[model samples]
Target: MLNRNNLYFIRRKVTNHIMLSLTFLSVVLTVLPLLLIFYYTVTKGLTSLNLDFFIAMPKPVGEAGGGMANAIVGTLILIGIGGAIGLPVGIMSGTYLAEFGNNKFGNVVRFLADVLSGIPSIVVGVVAYTIVVLPMHHFSAFAGGVSLAILMIPTITRTTEEMIRLVPHSYREAGLALGIPKWKTSLVIILRSAWKGIATGVLLAFARAAGETAPLLFTALGNRFWSTKIFQPIASLTVYIYDYAKSPFTEWNDQAWTASLILIALISLISLLFKFLTRSKY
Candidate 1:
């Protein structure tokens, strides 16, 4: 008995309600896993947290009260080296792809990036082993950084390309109209306009690299003692966690939990810092 307009309105409302419910469900699915990970990590890891965990070296097996200070420092060094290698290369490569991507060579580069992005992390580790580790005659932090940088490149390149492409073409024209060179306009106006998004990509690449362990295994090789040399084996949070979690020692297991917490905290802090940086400019 309803009029056609009334029927159409009712059907539209029902469709919208259904769509809204689905969207909410998808959001919950995405968020619930993250929330669970945070809860589990915090609860289990808090019991083992202590000052020595940050300042002191790991005690000899069967000893208690050692910290992951060396591991923490080693991670920082690896990330720094990797970032230095990857960030600029990724940015430049991405700019090229975005600006000059409508060509055969660009298609090849895009194909390569896509392939690398899908490659396994362990496969990258093996490749690094064959190349960097073998040439050096031993595992080293330098090789580990190289491996991580390789993993980061495709991702950063893609993200940077996408972010740069998102900048309005009008900006480019405006800069050109002002007598700016194409390269200068791209760097000064276009890049500045999209800086926040590009930074987010860099941070994301950093985070992804930080979480890898297999690549380090074939390269850094895990040092138990403090080693500042880039060519020397070094500890990282993920590698340290791997070693500790496998040990029969209850104390080592507890320390592993603490290390897990610390790694999570460090990554979270980095993410928050970048988030603030992005928002501050906007």
Candidate 2:
């Protein structure tokens, strides 16, 4: 039998070991599901991934061996337009909130942005449908882009505001002390300092917009063939995944898995890029 002092020391050692084991177990549990998802996606999607899947147009129903080249291209186009619209507007709003947000109107603007961010994306799609699709009397890529940009605006706004606020007020004062205009100081000193963080926000918004399907359904309306005109219908990866996954055909089903893999990869890449950019010494 050990002395009481030795017993106490053993108890502390055992407790520490147990706590460490629990921490490692928790990590494993968290990572297990992600590992399973990646394994399944790779196993199922690899067979369907081919050169033709990137180069060829989507085939009609009852056909075999087709690709989502149009959807790929359209997805890029919609995101491009959405980012263009959201980036400047979001940056401006964020700058306003950060610099002039002590007032009641600024509070109202921030509240509105929070409300907009929380609104369901499907609801934004409906609003865009009413404003753009109905007015144009057609389902067009422009409407889809508008819907995505609406979804992106709030996130970008909040992120930009947060990043700009992190810039030391001393930097602002220094520029102003040099007799620079407030606007010029904001643009040159504050915004430039926070550009990397803003870029992360923009990339995150782009990834989110790329994955949306509901907004595009009633807006872009899913083109089967290649279409470059923003005024015309367009294909999108999310819509294609939705349409193909529910089909009875085995090939389309496989393609859906591949599309899912692509989407997952794209999102992960964006997140990784954000992590890298934030870690960099700008």
Candidate 3:
């Protein structure tokens, strides 16, 4: 026997309560784990972080006052090389998928990209080791870069394709109506329009490659010394963390924590940069 006003008020209250509950649940599910990881990393890892940790080389097990310079350099070189190999190929393939490859060949390529994306990182590492390391008779930063490039290609290609597709058809149509060549329109107008999304994808791909350990495990083989040569084995942060954390020495473990913190910070900065870049574009 509720009045109409009472009934309406009750419905609104219930809806608001449901939305509040959902919002709380979502926040807990998403933010809680991230908070916990940040807390743990800062607590365990920050203690080992210092100027020496960044500037000097790794010391013997019991000694301190060393840095992760070699590892940091190796990581940069590997990621740079990987991006160099993967970026152009991925962008071109993605452009084709979205622009001109609208046939059976395109479908097959898309399917293969999907499959490649799903393949495990360790498997990719194994493939790289077999094909690159074994054949070349050495583990090197170049091999690790090639392996990471393989992993990055699929992600970049997929993201590029989707981002390009999101560009309004009207842009392409307008370019065509202006009598611009089709290739020029697709490359210039459509690509510029979706550049933000593509840039975001590229940043994400770099972040993804930055943390990869499995591929580098076999391909790079974790050198302790600074290596300027691409053909020589190089130590990366991921492999350094893995190797140090598992060692019997407590100092190595601390160094591992410091390196892990550096990695988390780097990835977080990249993600924030991507967010800012995309937001600015809009």
Candidate 4:
């Protein structure tokens, strides 16, 4: 057998080596792509970045000056509507899964949720087109919002359930011991404790929904004019970027790059907010 001193030295050396390797790998895997994306976007998109891009409406194809204000507004409206439609339903479903669900029914619901999460965004757009756009006789922002809501729901439900599950069982026991109703305990005590996690999930869902282009393609129909009406077809930032990027015009391409940069910034901000919200205070 090795001497105690030698054994200790060997173990320490092995552990330090392993930790160094893991740290290096983690840095490479996570930081490299983010740095590259940021560098590329800032370099290319900064040229077209201006206040007018955020304030003015899109002009005709050959027009000298224009902006994506309409698309920006429409994106916000669609995301807001989607959040309104999905948030409560997802939270309720998650509450059921974490608190009340069991056995076969819960399993089936979970499977369906996972399946929905995996479905392609384009397929969702197709379904929305058939059900809402076709039946209504026109594409509208509402239909696009509904499609995004469908995509958001599964993500929120899964995250909420996981967050609720992470709450300590001791809390539940204490609530029960106090003779609190089970529903009240679950909603009030458990959910409150898990609020940060739920908020993180909601923000993540919003980020994902905001970036989706396929669902809005057929439903919103990509307008160039400012549209405040929920019942009217509208343009969104994602669709605008996608369409403009493919155009031959240099100006349109520049706008696309700028819009993409803005979208990336928004997603990064949301992610940072989630991290801030979830960071331990102590």
Where model 2 places Cα greater than 4 Å from the true spot, the runs are 1-18, 268-282
Model 4 backbone overlap count: 0
Q: Per-residue lDDT of 1-282 in model 3, one digit per residue for the tens?
A: 999999999999999999999999998999999899889889999888988887888887767669899998898899999999999888888998999889999999999999998899999999999999998999998999999999889888988899999998999999999999999998888888888888877887898899999989979988889886889999899999998899998888888888999999888887888788678633
Please, what are the lDDT tens digits per residue for candidate 1 over residues 1-282? 999999999999999999999999999999999999889888989877988889998899877688989999999899988998999899889888988788999999999999999999999999999999999899899999999999999989998899999999999899999999988887788878888899888888888988899999999989889887999998899998999899998998888888989988888888999888889643
Error at 275, model 2, angstroms: 6.8
Worst 10 residues of 2 by lDDT: 273-282
Error of 1 at 30 (Å): 2.8
Please provide, for model 4 over 1-282, each residue's C-alpha lDDT reduced to its tens digit, 9 standing for 90 to 100. 999999999999999999999999998999999889889878888878889899998888788768889888888899999999999999989989999877789889999999999999999999999999999999899999999999999999999999999999999999999999999999999999988988888997899899999889989988878897999999899999899899999989988889989988878887897888788889
Give the Å error, residue 15, model 2.
4.7
Clashing pairs in 2: none
Off by over 4 Å in 1: 1-26
Note the Cα lDDT for every prediction shown: 0.91, 0.90, 0.90, 0.91
lDDT of 2 by residue, 1-282 (tens): 999999999999999999999999999999999999999888998878998888889887788888988988898889888888998999999998998787999899889999998898889989999999999999998899999999999999999999999999999999999999998998889999998888888887888898999999979989998998999999988999999999999999999989888888877887887788678665
Span of ten consecutive residues with least summed lDDT in model 4: 58-67
Task: For model 2, give the RMSD to the true fold.
Answer: 2.4
Error of 4 at 250 (Å): 0.3
> How close to the true structure is residue 253 of candidate 1, measured as C-alpha lDDT?
86
The Cα RMSD in angstroms, rounded to one decimal, for candidate 1 relative to the true structure is: 2.6
For model 4, which pairs clash?
Answer: none
